[model samples]
Target: MSKDAPPHISGTPESSAKARARKLRMPPLRRRRLEFDDVNVVDKAMMKKAVGGTVVGNTMEWFDVGVYGYLAVTMGAVFLSDADKDAQLLFSLGVFAATFIARPLGGVVFGRLGDRIGRQKTLAITLIMMAASTFIIGLLPSYDTIGIWAPILLVLMKLLQGFSTGGEYAGATTFVSEYASDKRRGFLASILDLGSYMGFALGAAVVSVMQLLLSESDMVGWGWRIPFLIAGPLGAFAIYFRLKIEESPAFQATLDAQEASAKAGDETESLGTMGIFRAYWRPIVLAMVLVAAVNSVGYALTSYMPSYLTDSKGYDPVHGTLLTIPVLVVMALCIPLAGKLSDRIGRRPVLWIGAGSTIVLAVPAFMLIGQGPVATTLLGLLLLAVPVTFYVGNLAATLPSLFQTSSRYGAMGISYNVATAVFGGTAPLIMQGLIALTDNDMSPAYWLMFTSVAGAIAVIFMKESAQRPMPGSMPSVDTEAEAYELVAGQDENPNLDVDSLPFDTLGSQQGTQSDADPAPAGTADHR
Candidate 1:
């Protein structure tokens, strides 16, 4: 079959079905998916496959991301000078953040490309970009051989990686969630974070091994690039596997419908940045908030933790890795569980748990960890690790759901990039300064907690898509209220112990404080 040929996706609703034949010349999607006899609802099996693909793809991308940050300490000297080590490291991190800044642009570019061409194609190209750029970073000339251009080239490569990463997560999550059966989405979507943690674990292991193999001089001189070189083959390997996964059923259905209805007099708005901005700015803003919350915490732990421990807590770098291994492992294990629970309960409550706890725990955990002995630090980290998992695992599906698929890429890509660039990208730098300003007595945990508070507040108003009408099924009959309404009343559902979930998370305009409180433990939403 041709690469673009539709694979059999098991269960997509017949969103385009017409009541009778001889429909007036309608939009292409209305005619194709709606007119077809084979269309059906997306079920759990297809949802599982969608999630599987995303996990594999994200795993590859994140593996390299984690490896780079972990190894950068040993390798920092290759591209920088002794006189300016601290400044150079900061510049390197700046380069890292620079990549994040480009994500939104990539989102708009790749997202529109995906909407116009196909999600699978766009995704494949992005994976290629991420792997290829990371690999090339391994090959770049160092400061000793070249000069300023080396760092410039390094920044360029980072930009490429950032741009591609922008669309990868949102595209994969949306692709998976949109195809999932209604109740299955949160669980399956959480699989994305599982893949992320898998990458994190592997990256940690890879760098730890590299640290053992090479002396500091050799590692800084040449050995540092080898991991990046591995990414080239790794990217190719991931693409090979990704090729086997099915295209998003929703995207595929749209493609077929769009092609069928393209003959003449179609009213579908072409997905352009301007078009996306005009229609989806609000949801786009929400998606950005979602990415920033988890991403800020993510960078703090994965990227900043090594330094945080060594600089602030008086731990050795290699030992810090040993300490970090458990935290990363725990986070990996918990993310999927949180995601599955979200599927069973709902995204809103999962998000509430994640954001609320992070806000509350950030300060206390940091303060205690900073003051602790090795065991205490580990215990404090154990506590910190819990809430981070909740946020990362659940945001998998929640961020993408904020925008319509028609413009999801643009919305999520840009919003995530822009928000992270402003907040998450600078979180460590700013937090470090805040601690220094406070005479190094205060914990960044509190700063992280405070930093994440805005995001938690932002999430309070986030839209829940749990009961969103399945794609390929009827367009919402009550479009206006359906679009804004958070919940379909469950007063009649026998299983719903509504009182157990105190806040009006059912799309009610409840304040952030009430919306975020976890239900007494053992309830569906809280559990």
Candidate 2:
């Protein structure tokens, strides 16, 4: 009759024997006590280094992206001198999309490596590959010199950039998310994008300055390579910062746990590529849809807009590149604010604002850009930047929460890059091809609207992770006092679901005997 006792049965002898057999066969309900050692105390200095290193490398990665995007037209001319205007442009955009072709492979390889070796080591390798490839692009000979080899070489370099980049963002997000305290994760993770757009704005600024200072012929002749060449030094600076930082505490703890389990003769199943797909497919699919939506808008704003402005809106390349710089700078500055707001309100609400704004503003934003005045174009860009600020600022923090710490990086790499390859990287080509086919300048707007709708729907299914510990990790806090507070209050804390922690699941798998008996089945929360 006690609340904690097992259910009583009244039955015939045969039925009673069957019931007892069933009870004996059932697995025990696993549980553990919350303890101080389970809480991760945030080291402030290490947290700062982690954030700085990750953000700087992210900036460099996006800087390469910005350079390639802003220079698409010029590169087309340089690489395909015999092609007509439209052919040249199309070829260039196709090459940009081609970069993403290699990203999924990069994601798989580096994702697995990061999970196996360490996030820090894998990230360093990716940065080196990306920087080296970008620098190689600047040194490539023109189409006039290399005949067919020019475009071929260009495509190869872009693919390399894409390959390296596949690992960069996912690893960076995983790293920073693991380093941050639960309450400030949103704000801290948002700093990655602040660096991202700042890198973008810096690239735009560099290209614009080059365009302004040089004649059109001079730019096509050699000036365009300047931006790509800049990656060498920028990458070195980023790598320096990156190498100084240590691995994230959550990942380290997971590694340690795995080692200890191994030493005890408990073999945990490794979630390889197919295993990850099997175990976390729903979250993987959900993450893909969300990524598709966010990156569609993102690629539209960063990669396609410059070409659109130049080709359709009748702005010269100078003004087209120049117009986006201010908008990017303003957007970059506001990213952290949006991130902080997510921390205060919740991630879903902030994401909803992004998705809703995209749906509402896409048409008007395009219309303003279509008007062709300088002021109208800038206004339109700012309108588009609104949703982007909300979406990208929270994405790094949000996506990593979907999977457990054991497989977060691998799952993210697979989901994010696959979506980006399918939808994000190809946005410019798709938008441009749509317009060419239908002659609708608003085609890109409709695409943005569609993706945002999908994104909004995805948000509905997402678990709210704001101010909570990441899955498969302990409650992370900034101070020892906070750690004590968390441990004491954990039973009543809405965010701290101690029953659902990995220890229970892992312990159950070990079939390890324990002195304490399991809780009764009906009383346990399975997940």
Candidate 3:
């Protein structure tokens, strides 16, 4: 036999057919997975990884927000040069609001992707978009050089930044919450806001330093660009870490459940966006109202406060920015602690206390700041900051827990963004209008007081979400209406039997099994 001879083949037709059949019997290869594919979704090993990536990314996003708000005066002078100083500031703040206008659309689009694809992926995309737009703003020509193109381009960039931001916070909160144990969900989620305030503080600090060191002309000319440009490297660093993390285990578990359902011939209707709206509308409205309070108070304290101090209260702008630094630091520290408190006690009590205090103190706090010899002004801000942190810290955990997991991202995104756009985004503009109209330095205080009423309504109606099983993991979606009644200490029927109610009434009739029927043991980790 020759050494290079082919394998001996039977010449018969039967044998040839048999060989072809054998070839066909070989099994197909399995799809390859990435290295971290098998890692636990809530892996203890990845806790620090998840926290760091989320905080850094959130910090960068909010840092841009901080820069825009803090540098509004300088940005206005540069980009809206044709207007008087007052008009320029108004125009600049108007550009800032432009970002909020696009936020709801961003929320819906990004929320869909987050729900459909994965949380980590949506977050990464948002971070990249936000960072790029922010960096580009740094390179824009002043109105003096580019004429009408300056404000026009500024508005467009603000739109992009707003769009990207629409998805960022909701996605980050969803990612962090899914990885966290329900017992600690409040504390963990609060860190997202902690990073946010830190970024705002950092932006203010940077601008304040520049204001102190640079000439007024220099700050208006080019110094403002440095803060915007810093976003580039910061975003890159966040992206690198974000890419290394595993997908959220809760999301992956949902996928596993869906696939298993498909194989078992259980054809459940997937609720599209409209379906989500129909089923989750009540909770969505409540969440939106709650966010309105948060943003209004937050922006008033952080963004509009600087301008109010300088323009209305007669404090130097530089000194005002510096004075607000301690208030921010106090908020940062209190945020995590408040989160922990929510975890131990409950979310509603903490929220109610915060909202209630704001109603009482808004006018007094504003008056103190207006009449200040610097020390009293700082004290007044500190009083307001404490209440603000209570709401901000618990928001990440409470908002997402408002609805079922399947539609959580969408509901939170749309509701939160809409509230933010209308209230938080407009805070500075509204304050300006109020001050101009009333000729009162404390006009902003009255606005804050009015907004606090919404916060009170939200807390009174919102159900306690602490340590509850997440929505989809259970066999049924939670009814927010029912929860509200239960937590508000209202009994719909003391005499009604629990078993008398229809099984499907708990969750909407969209693709969910009866609550009475137990799900497969392996499908979810209820704890």
TM-score (all chains, Cα) for each model: 0.80, 0.91, 0.82
Pairing residues by index, what is the TM-score of model 3?
0.82
> lDDT per residue, candidate 3, 1-527, as tens digits?
44444444445666668778888998886533211121122456666688888898899899899988888878889998878988988898898888899999899999988987888888999999999999999999999998999999999999999999999988888878777765678998999999999999998998898999999899988998998999889889988888877776666666555566678887455556666666667777888888888888899888888877776777776887888888998899889999999988899988987788788888878877877699899988987896799889899998887765666677678888988999989989998998889998777877887787888897787768786545543221124333334334323433222332223322222322212112222231121
* 1 against 3, candidate with superior lDDT: 3
Question: Model 1 — TM-score against the truth?
Answer: 0.80
Q: Candidate 1 residues 194-291, lDDT tens each?
A: 88877877877777777778777777788788878888888888898676667665555555444544655554556456655655566666666766
Candidate 3, residue 300: the lDDT equals: 88
Cα deviation at 66, candidate 1, in Å, is 1.3
Better of 1 and 2 by lDDT: 2
- Which of the two candidates, 2 or 3, achieves a greater lDDT against the reference? 2
Clashing pairs in 2: none
lDDT ranking of the models? 2, 3, 1
Worst 10 residues of 1 by lDDT: 510-519
Estimate every model's Cα lDDT from 0 to 1: 0.66, 0.87, 0.77
- Reference-based lDDT, residue 395, model 3: 90
Q: Best to worst by TM-score, what's the order?
A: 2, 3, 1
Deviation of model 3 at 34, angstroms: 32
